[model samples]
Target: METTFVGRHVEIAQVARLMRESRLVTLTGLGGVGKSRLAHRVVEESVAEFPDGLWLVELACLTDPHLLPETVADVMGLADQPARRRAEVLAEWLGPRRSLLVLDTCEHLVEAVASLVDTLLRAAPRLRVLVTGRQPLGAPGEHVYSVPPLPVEDAVALLRERAGLAAPPDGSGGEGGAAELAELCQGLDRIPLAIELAAVQLRTLPPTVLLRRLNDRYHLLTGDGGPVRHGSLRAAMGWSHELCTPAERLLWARLSVFASGFDLEAAEYVCAGGPLPAGQVLEALTGLADKSLLQREEHPTGVRLRMLDTVREFGAEWLSRLGEDSAVRGRHRDHYLRLARRCATEWPGRQVEWYGRIRAERRNLRKVFELCLADPQWSRAGLDLAGTLWFLWVCCGMSREGRHHLETALRADPGPGPERLRALWVCAWVAALQGDLAAARERLDQCRAEDPEGSVTGHVLQVEGMLALLRRDHARAVELLEEAMAWHMAKGGVLSGLLPCHALAALGLLAAGRPAEAVETLSEGQALCEVHGEEWSRAQMEYVFAWAGHVEGEASGALRHARSALASALGFEDLSLSAACVEMIAWAVTEEGDAGGGAWLLGVAQAVRDSLGLPRSGSGIFAPVREQTLTQAVKVLGGAGFDTLFAEGQGSDLGIAVKYALGEKIS
Candidate 1:
């Protein structure tokens, strides 16, 4: 939206009209035809009718078909719950909304995208899907629009507009330069990316000289692969590649290792080395950005650099040609591995910042995980990475994805080692959370049998206690959790392990009706969290405090603590904790006699839970209290009145609901 958009009025109007008539529309064209850009502009213009939200999913970075749902969910700002099919959860949440879902560059995953789009469309009747790809997905009742190349005149305008940044165009050639410019656009097949790539050359090349160079460029890259229509892009890309310095060319090739765009630090670490020194990477990157080979996106933290898919593909081919693909990939794997360790180590504080960084690196992380699992040498690294990110899987909303990665790593690299043992423990914990108790126990037993030194005994005890708590064996859960805490203490304080231990122990106390003990138990966790500046784990303890306070009829205390917990929970993107906090908030609100507000919050909580596929397997223990809260709200606001308020909350977007829950004034 920030860039100056050239003319596409006819295509834009056609796409918008198609969207009005069809729930699913696919824009098909050659690689550089600007389908994605057109889709963005069309959606921006047509967003008023879709009140729920507008989500754009970029599929170019996703190679594995299985990750499609998770990728889409990530774009939707959701961390999927474990056990429930991600698609089912997505549909359940979207079933009542009017949202626009845009899938860009899905040509590589047509079948998978088609299936998912079909499911969401069927379930969310009000949902509309607009897709841009090289070809149509062929979904039933799909409207396919073949996006033509930009008109030669519009392409000339774009080239002129783009070239204007450096200097005004020369109006000296053949009838106000129209002939020369149109020839350039036609030579480039009127493809926007190719034209833009050539337009930047105008800063150095005169229009006549550029048109002459295009002839040589076309013959230069003759017989190259791809549709004939894509020749302009390939030639334009080849010409640009030829023009770049050696450092820039090598940097471009090496930077292809990143699954998505990356920050400067990443480029320096991963793309620098060999001919291109680390010190020179920034300059080369700047050159590439200047040439329009890389796109610079400014974020709150810094500027991110990304290559268009077509350009990246060209670089990838060159990376292979230079026989540096494997080596670059290894470097990439190591860089992200170090990043993972840093994130784990620094997670004591800055939990919110950690979440942001992790969310930003999600696609790259997935790429690294896949690479690790696919290669034996990196199997241990994969297992280690998955195990180390337990906070992401357990505390954040990624239990399902965590479980998948852990399971894959476990199967890929089977052995008796620290990484395997930890992966086993983490996998069991995720399993227990997902309600697969049998698998959870099996993995826990494997940990004990394989871990001869029993280093993870504390972890084993904690998860076993969690299973017991899930089974409603409160006394047994309390005993085992205390034992786990004792084990952690004897082991010289597994601080990371101790935090969750304390929270679970407090929950066991509260579940067993010992609210006083729960409060006392949580105070220690609060102190521990404060000592370390731990927000995520501390948020969990706060939720337990809210729970204990509510159980003891301290509605005001519950409300206060719930508010604190929900804020941090949201910061860390922990929807499970958010749901728990919101439920506690609703309970306190209803008890304080704002039954209407409580009823609305209750609806918000349920909708969030359903979106997460909550109240499943491991989390059904709170059903009783939830039912009681619902009944109380219904009594205060009669059944019909309650449904109206509840539906209102359910129908609201996650952001609006979160704002209202956080005390923002909303109708």
Candidate 2:
């Protein structure tokens, strides 16, 4: 192997040592400090010792907080496992195999990463995880190696390499020129990022003249150090900013309003205010990309753009300095508000093709919420945003952020009226989803106290009933669902629409213990989904079908239904449905008396959970059947070990099983 590390021998050795001694090694450092570069080098050098191949999962492109694990699973080439249900599979696959899993750039998804690493470490005794990020993964036995910048001489040497220049002559400069240049580079931290940037200018500008220009205190010198701040690479980002064109700088400042990566339309909408023209957004974006400031990637949705944390920080600082924060935030807020309204309007029909599209835009929605909350005047706008996202938040399990924004909006003093009712109902619904049963009941009571027969009260009942079903309060669930349906029907309400149908299906299935009947009822809701084109309905209906098939002892059929459900699950990026689907598949495979297949499916499901960074319930329709099937399968597959069976790849292939069970080719 060509060991081409310019000057990171000490860090590399430390990482290698950590890898040998510890189960987890985390290389935490600022961006551009070569943390990723160093980790890659170490893995390449040491990976030959492991039986399993080294796996690298780069999380820089990950924007959705909930899908971090799923992304990892995807990178590992395991697509059959449903959302948040792959951890066990990952652990099972790695448990007996000696392997190194390298997770790169994990700051944005810290919690999920922590949970996943924790699970994998516990399950796989020999597997080692190497993570490079701004912060540590914070797991036990975690060996954190902080990567510092290169030493001055080494940094200058590397810069020269990148700049394609020979070493400067000793005393070639008169007076303090060499010292001045070195001092400038030192202030920039002798970081590889800063030195390389300064080296670039060396093609045209002499080190002395560049040093002189850098001496001016006001203008940012090209030489800036890379420092890991807030567990993110923010400091090195400054140097990249100092090298931007005026137009690019302007665009960079405005683009900070985005919470996650965005498409071109978003750039035109938010970054196009003031001097930056809509036409120039793409030009500026391309400029940034060329400079290695912004990352451009092709997503399933579209070509999306992203920035490093440090770079985004610098952009935000510039935005603040230019006093464009408020105006740009307004545009961001306005853009998402319009988007929410559009999604809400179309949510009732077949325009539902855009459900996943809208789900993907949730980061922008969060940014809008922040903007709205910051300016009291925009609280009404915040109300609209939160109210519109009620279904997504409650039904889709974004209750964490949804409830947060709802409370913030409620406290912001938006005037009392029907809109207030909407916000109140959302708060109640969020509380219920969060399992704050007391708070949910209190909020519902408050809404009813205000107007017992109001539209908001109906929503409260819907959530109450849904919560009841979640807690297995089947009788209470039925009562609440019935009351909600009656209230809505009496009001002839079509606005808080899907809740009634969802409540109906949930109560019917749970009470009747008839998954097939529940599927039929939920299918009625699908017509509404077809009319509205909302994907949540599709996901909900899939849940019903999967559960029903599992209950009816049709494991093969259940797996088929679960696979079909995944499109809608992927559409909404909903982890719950993904988990449900995977659980069902695992159960179904085991039920077919295929121990090897069940084990493989279990491992696949665990992989999904690991990728999702969470646990799942196996009590539902598919879960119980899956457990029973797996119990029998595990006995049959346990010769030397289950891991051996997994390694042997002896499971009945999913393709064969699908054909035998569903009478159709699996997508």
Candidate 3:
């Protein structure tokens, strides 16, 4: 690591102070504006403060986001690193080390990098993060310093020095153009990578001519030096792309489907479509990363991978050239469609896997939903995705996203035949989950009004019952549940799946105050889930059991089952289940005479609720659970306490649940 830096003197001092004041210091700037160089200097200069040697995790060569934490662990020489999770290992390793960790070029892998940074900051008191990227990581307590490009005079001087060229002649001739060229460099976003690229054209082309060419031929004007080492920003991406093998190229082309971020499993599942094998995606991804085409980073629970804007642009061009955009996107839609259908079929059972898969595919899947709604031919695909993700919105805790897409698709084609009716029911379910009983009623009324004798009437009724329970309409909820239950029996057990059963249990157990019967109903649901191989559904059953036990004075039993539910929720990345279980734990803590513990749990639930952007309907699971937990907690502690839990959970757009019970807003 070199302690010497050419520019960014102010940036260095500011960043150093931020690091001293905060554990996490993020350095964001346009690419190649000496971010990496500046970071290297800071670590080298600050290296003596850290008794433990500085650890550098160069994201430039890491393609598989899942491998990021493990890569860091390897650099730190830690053994027995788990393949499935590396962040945990990293946090444990850094827990005691007083060291500087430089995370370079993390813009592409923003989500994963944010997660890892968060965990390390939480677990390691003495460890400091020096991150460089195109944007601030948006982590808590992160002091961000945006590094600008070199000044014009400095830029000209640096260009002359690097290109080994003479200063332009005074005035007249092309001299004025030289000054104009320097100005043009600043307009190119003051990005050092862009400036260095512009300097390369000086050797072969006059300044004015080169500037004129830059507008139309960004690729040509971007290069300097020899053809082999073009050294232009565009050339850098091109160079990286060219080094990829055919399989890697194919994967890279397909990866353009993602508008935001994605994970390895998603890449393998969607990008592989006969071009690359699942077994080799990790390796091909590695190849792309080695070429600087893809970047990998670690999230708290998983990995998120991304491509630079310039690199992604190159990939988009390549994808267009291949004429495979539509084909690949269709494949992307189909894969997620199949997944949505499968997960919907298995919902409320294997809650952990459900949330995990949703969390992994949420970003790309949202794009797929857009494509489906945009094209009539793909509208059913959109409906399928929206319909299947309904559980994700309601039970799994993704109602905000679910409602957004569902409403979009429904508006695109609002007709209530059977499929449309199902969509309506799903839409209603989302509204109900959000505690917007009014909205749920409105959608339901529209469904009934449009199709009085539709085939999906039974499904509509089932949702009606579920919403009734959600709104504490125990009597109406029970009647609706029974009616839908009889209809399911009449139809040979069709729509009487998890939601209906869960609705019945919720009504019978909570609203009706029959904890024993609710326990029995939940037990039956669990057995059915196991028989049907619905792990996510079974987790929901466990959550019900926990809820019932909490109400029945069996705090120990409730805690044990809630833990199981949470484990399953994590496995599935089911936000709803995680939130539900957290709420349940809070309730149990209150029941167990641990008001302080209960408040903490409520705080976490609030954070989860806010992060998922769960609507504040004052009736949804979170609100009801939060209210009940707080009410009981007040009883246990003689008051709800002076702290407001909901206010503490608002950390940022990332929406990390700060605490489980209190629902404190995070600033």
Task: Put down candidate 1 lDDT per residue, 490-534, tens digits, no spaces.
Answer: 886544578889999999999999988888989998898899878
Clashes of 3: 56
Least accurate 10 contiguous residues by lDDT in model 3: 646-655
The segments of candidate 2 whose C-alpha lies over 4 angstroms from its true place after superposition are 1-10, 22-32, 36-146, 151-189, 199-208, 217-245, 347-384, 394-420, 423-443, 467-496, 499-503, 506-523, 542-562, 582-667
Clashing pairs in 1: none
Which regions of candidate 1 are displaced past 4 Å? 165-176, 223-229, 493-495, 616-620
Separately for all candidates shown, the number of backbone clashes (residues 3 or more apart, or on different chains) is 0, 34, 56
Q: What is the lDDT of residue 659 in candidate 2?
A: 38
- TM-score per candidate, chains pooled: 0.95, 0.69, 0.62
Each candidate: RMSD:
2.3, 7.4, 12.3
Candidate that would win on lDDT: 1
- TM-score comparison, 1 vs 3, better candidate: 1
Candidate 3 stretches greater than 4 Å from native: 1-10, 14-231, 241-254, 260-287, 296-306, 321-325, 342-351, 489-500, 513-516, 546-667
Models ranked on lDDT: 1, 2, 3
Q: lDDT at 462 for candidate 2?
A: 83
**Residues 460-499 of candidate 3: C-alpha lDDT, one tens digit per residue:** 7777887767666777776777677667666754323443
Error of 1 at 604 (Å): 0.3
